[model samples]
Target: MYRSRPGATIKAIATDLGVNPETLRNWIRAAGAGHGRGRTEGAPAVPGSSVEADLAAARKRIRDLEEERDILRKAARYFATETGW
Candidate 1:
């Protein structure tokens, strides 16, 4: 409905769409359509090869950190009780 009108306020769009104005705002934000505006200009740029590799490495590092954190927590608990603290 908002698309059809093109110049309607968020409240008006929400009323026509039978949804809350905030919900419409969230939709706009997530779609990267900009506030009270239409779809963004130009096609999204694809990540470069190096960018993809970096992301993979970051994810692996995150997983390793989580495993280390769990091990440290378990060791702490074990030592805490063992030392009668």
Candidate 2:
């Protein structure tokens, strides 16, 4: 396939396939094989990325912060009740 070839520009491939470059690009994206212009230029994404791990950690931290804030709010309310404020 033309996709596996090195230095295969969309324009060149489109011309060879007798289709517009945009059409070929759209077909590539629709097929779920597209990675923009990066991979073709040699910036490949590694397998088993850490992005998901980082995102999960961030979400967990946000949940922890929310819980801490709620506990502090309850404590403040309890102290106010004890002091009749």
Score candidate 2 by TM-score against the native.
0.47
| lDDT digits (tens) for residues 7-53 of candidate 2 | 88888999998999999888777555577443444433443346778
At residue 44, give the lDDT of candidate 1: 41
Highest-TM-score candidate: 2
| Native-referenced Cα lDDT, model 2 | 0.76
| lDDT of candidate 1 over 1-85, digit per residue (tens) | 5545777888988887899999987776665665545555563424366688999999999999999999999999999999999
Span of 10 residues, lowest total lDDT, candidate 2: 39-48
Report every candidate's CA lDDT: 0.77, 0.76
